[model samples]
Target: MMPPVARAQAQVLPGMGDGEMTASAERQLGDTIARQIFRDNDFLDDPVLVEYIQDIWQKLLAAARLRGELTPELDERFAWTILLGRDRDINAFALPGGYMGVNTGLIAVVGSRDEMATVLGHELSHITQRHISRILSRDARNMPLMVAAMVLGMLAAAKSNSRSGSDVGQAVMMGGQAAAMQNQLNFSRDMEREADRIGFGVMTQAGYAPQGAAAMFEKLQYASRLNDNGSYPYLRSHPLTTERIADMQGRAQLKPGADAAMPLVMDHAMIASRARVLSRPGVDVLRVWVQAAGTTEFAKGSPAQQAGMLYAAALSANELKDYGVARDMAARLRERTAGNAPAARLARLLAAEIELSAGQPARAGALLDAKARDRPEMMLSAQAAIAARNPAPMVGPLRDWVATHPRDATVWRTLGMLYTAQDEPLRAIRADAEANVAILDYVAARDRFKAAQDLMRRPGAGPVDHYEASIIDTRSREVDILVREQHAEEKKAQR
Candidate 1:
């Protein structure tokens, strides 16, 4: 028999596992399975994907703080990824290791950031409780059964295998399998109940109305009933029941002494605006919703409701590319409320974006630079500065920011990209290397290193002897390991 580590490595591919494996063997097997799952799915190694993941993660992280569920320790391992699915199904899922994916369809359905945060918080709880890891570990004891369950679970996850990495069909298939897994899979009913109970707690703690989760589930249930069965993967995998709704209501009511004085955090407007930016049809529709909200029974019902309506309108206009109108509305909002950070930040960012889009890069640079200085730790402002035409000057500020905020891989990646843009290949390579380490993924880091070497080999490029040799040496070692793994697999198959 192979040693635990070797046996684990051998079982890296999907549907292949070491039955009754030791802890080390199980971990190796899990890593192998994860690698195969990612590889077979045609995952892209693009910066845009990385940026999108980082953006969503940051937003959720902030939401976690508002709910008081996030601590420094939790923040370190709480990473997420957004998978763009082509499916029309409104769904999302979170893996045990902080991997949460939001379908484009789900993005369409969510009317506000608060609602999305409700979803994210619920999923985050699953990871925080180590549900996925526990499930996987249990599966390792029964290899065949685990494989079958995983196939179903992955289906529930909405897996895809597309070159563009955005195929909804793949995800739908995965989601379907996941639903099936619930029936025959090994996870206990107690686990589901606990997840529901804890997820509701996280959502309310994040300052969201605990009712949002119940409302969302109700909506999903209604939608599912309206269509044939299995229309929504999320509902299918989650399996909403009357009991689940009652459970949530019970949990929500349990917190009678909850902070009633807590301010209602409004993120709907931003969500509506972002949806508009990403969806052309959604822009006009959201704009109408925003406009109707002002005078409708909804806005006239209450002061808080009216404020939310106005905010949504301003956000809609911003999404429609009506910057001047958006700015005016934002200013009005700032006047209405003394401490409207969202309104102020949105206005500032919109103004900068407008300048950049209008080909006034220098003006954008100045605005962003000043903002970055004022909010020295603001990632968005730092990113805006990095996007400026001559980001060379901003590099020093970015480096300083990174020193203080070392966990932000996006900043490191941005610095590396900026260095490359400025023809500083060596710096770019080093920055990218650091970013990769922060991510704890060698495959990505090795690719960035190769890019740096290629840049150094250009004509009149700086002395590349050391960097070039280093790249070759590092990359060769990585490639050797891959080759060895393939050889071992082949030998095993032959036997």
Candidate 2:
């Protein structure tokens, strides 16, 4: 027989079982919610931000897999996609079937990549442990739509933290059952504890500093002490307690000099600056960032601080149509970050982005390394090439990339533009359809796919590659089924 202490500890963890919810079902529900998100105007896919976040996210995923916490079945079945919302509320959340979200507000505030990684690792652990499934198993059961509504409501509430719990309850269509439904929406305290413990191990194993967890907790603790304004939306969902802070600090001590020194903040500073600007922090704020770059104080700051300010100023100047200032700042940024390869690369990307925005596509292409093939590079280069009417070279590379990363809606959309430039209407339509599919917009996807199919059916409709035609036909049928399934789910939810 187990000792009382051991038994109590064991009971703290949720049942390590799937219960009634299968992995596939969870993924389907996640798709439903994600489609809603994709349709939201605030959903953003800035290439620079996406690349930065994905770098940390993929590392955490690899760490989870290496530790055997992520089983092959779950890994294969889950979406594992991160969505970025442009909202300025500091929040990150895990959705069913491996979908995660990070608000730009959170990215703008974090002091280091390790701090961001800690948050992502925690969210990733929540998915790997099937926290959503376990919660549904006990409370939501077969009512996936009820849970989906509640999850969406939670997201809405998280975005606007001014909303009270009762507002969230009403938003989810739970009527006067606000208190009861709100309780159901949250993960149990035990689950939060589990996520912290597991997430700490995951982040450290992924090569992030262990101290990051402690630092993030301290930020949250500081926020909690202030008045509960809507700024710190993260606190609404992931409430901080002294015990949580103490737990992270105790774990940091166990590392014993691991990541004792602060991480080089250059890369994070640049990215966080980008996040802040991209979050649309108002014209007043943008003008301030632009003005700050030319200040004497800016000259006195450290390399990282200067790099960050330059990047933001450049981006903000571009936003404000001060292209000359934007270009000047970006060039200075590249020079400032020359010693750091990653940060330097970001500067180059920013320079290219500014040139592109300023309608100097040729200059944009020149700024990007001709030999580089990273996602952000490839994407920006593709746009530049198309703009320059030299789209041929990018076609092969973008095709290869999308073949491996089929769910990259941004790449697909860009590829469609490239195909259109090459005058391949059929291929462009197919690519457009695939882009729709990537966002889980099955209805629109089906229409585009069918349009491609119809084009292939037309006699003398340009050169028809038999293989491409076959693929389009298959995709058309697939998307048709998805559209039907989506409609059925909607009806079920309505009922």
Query: Which stretches of model 1 miss by more than 4 angstroms?
Result: 1-89, 103-118, 128-130, 133-188, 201-232, 257-264, 275-339, 362-388, 400-409, 432-444, 450-495
What Cα-based lDDT does every candidate model obtain?
0.53, 0.82
Model 1 scores a TM of 0.62
What's the lDDT for residue 395 in model 1?
77
Candidate maximizing TM-score: 2
In model 2, the runs with Cα more than 4 Å from the true position are: 1-20, 141-179
Clashing pairs in 2: none
- Supply candidate 2's per-residue lDDT for 452: 87
Index of the highest-lDDT prediction? 2
Q: Work out the TM-score per prediction.
A: 0.62, 0.89
For candidate 1, which ten residues in a row score worst on lDDT? 1-10
